[model samples]
Target: MHGARKAFACAVILATTALTSGQSFADEEVNVYSYRQPSLIQPLLDAFTAKTGIKTNVVFSDKGLGERIAAEGENSPADVMLTVDIGRLDTAKQLGIAEPIKSEVVAKDIPSQFRDVDGDWVGLTARARIIYASRERVDQTAITYEELADPKWKGRICTRSGQHDYTLGLIASMIVHHGEAETEKWLVGLRDNLARKPTGNDRAQVKSIYAGECDIALGNTYYMGQMETNDAEPEQKDWAASVRLIFPNAEDRGTHVNISGVILNKYAPNRDNAMKLIEFLTTPDAQEIYAETNFEYPLTPGVAIAERVKGWGELKPDDISLSEIAKYRKAASEMVDRVAFDDGPAS
Candidate 1:
């Protein structure tokens, strides 16, 4: 499936490249390289074009966008890059393809923690890494990231692979709070509590809970909204119905949250229009459209959240800097391997 997706993405990129090969600095259009699907983001792009009178051109793929832009060097037509996960945003900064954002609008609208200290990237929306507890078997009203390791929950927890970006993000946050030594111990304990070998995406874990294969699983909050609204696969609605969303650590440090973010390409040919687009994206109207489209929390304060997202209860996001979490991501991946977390419960 991944290969198929990559192949299709390559075809799309080739087509977009053909269209953009002749772009010059004087062009009125802004070119975008994105990891987000066009369907998921087209509304915002359309809205931008409608408001600003500048055409938006997009090249999209599930991965390799930053590398592609870097490989294109100064001739790259990409003006803005859009993607999810702190890891990808950090990688764009590391690749030297990101131009630091200096917009006063961005600084005023986005919180400091969600924007890079170096100003290379800024988050647009947020999602909490939360627990999906079975409505039938779990009576608890709340849980913490630390409690997933308790002996009482032995053979009860389910999750995707620890190496996945979402899991790594949470583990990275744990390392930030508890240190590497303590975080490793927690991973070992959590490994022993798994119901089965780690597998599947966030939505799959919720399916497992609905099937009674596990009492709890870790997943992002927007997935609940997706599952609940899935008309194509009605079974997912039942899966969503079977679990209660628990924002981990909400009572203390708050839930571990990650972002979907954007970067300005260092080689942008349409820099002025790109800056306008970037600044426009930070406005409340664009943020509201983003939140409604993706079921994610708006990064701009006071933007309305999606109705389904609001029903999940209020989110008190962990106040820790995401850049700090990004720093420990490598260490967190190492801890996942050191503990052999995907090997499932120790028999």
Candidate 2:
């Protein structure tokens, strides 16, 4: 029976080798061109890899990814394009760089208002363009999008440049909420009250408030949570502790929330894998990871929010469809320039 035992061992070794070889062949690596910074997205990518064994390769760039993808055209190696705002996503769709993908998983997880009706792209997580008020300086009851333009807020408001995507999206939503004429007026008013030249990112705006440079600032809700929970630096923890997050326009249109979403590249080499990845991301499990890691709201209903997010209280998201905001981006940019906002330092 020694010869029989030897044969059985040989058979087991061959089976294991064949299994490993098959997995290596089916690995099917997907290339992702992401607008999000690495720190904000790598964790999610790692998780997906751990669960699916489908290796993910990513090129992270904060700017010009859309243009690069467009430049590559049908020859592009990118299988998916991930971006932060509706304006940028619309640009990709307008350029015909993204192809429509139909998946019941994506359709069910993402709200119709957060994606293209034709299924070209789907939103995964959402962030509100809300106000951060200094606990020691501002009255909570006086908070509103319109209030930011009030004379009282003059010399007390801090914000990043209107040219930034986050600010541009907020302006686009304003264009939708209050037509061009009124939006122009609000832009002028907000511009006139800037605490410093439109500089730095949302986190910088929050830091400025903590430094006593301003009493109120425009920023995303996630940044506040990031700062509070960040163990990497003491200053970030302090910045988060110094302010309170307020949902703007609660009574009227509700707070404007934007999303980070993905679309299949028009020239995807592995269309089936691309659809699977998109489907995986929109699932309740993946959506929860997004909310917990990125501090953004899940696009899928019934997904529980992270405890830190729940602490900020519930939000009444603006009912306006994201496409409406994307539609008015051109007008919003023109208004931004017409007011000479890019000319000199804001306020």
Top model by lDDT, which number? 1
User: What are the per-residue Cα lDDT tens digits for candidate 2 across 1-347?
Assistant: 34422332343211111122345445566677788776677667766666666666677777887788787766666789889988888888888888987887788788899988767778889999988888888777436787777887788888887788888898999888889999889888888887767888999988898899999989998997889988878799888888888898787778999999998998886677777788889988789889989999998999988899888877889978888888888888888889976543353
Q: How do the residues 160-222 of candidate 1 rate in per-residue lDDT, one tens digit apiece? A: 999988899999999999999999888988999999999999999999998889999999998
Error of 2 at 37 (Å): 2.4
TM-score of 2: 0.90
lDDT of each: 0.88, 0.80
* Candidate 2 structure lDDT: 0.80
Could you tell me which residue pairs clash in candidate 1? none
| lDDT at residue 54 of model 2 (Cα atoms) | 68
Residue 188 CA error for candidate 2 (Å)? 0.9
Local distance difference test, candidate 1: 0.88
RMSD of candidates 1 onward, in order: 5.1, 8.9
Total clashing residue pairs per candidate?
0, 0
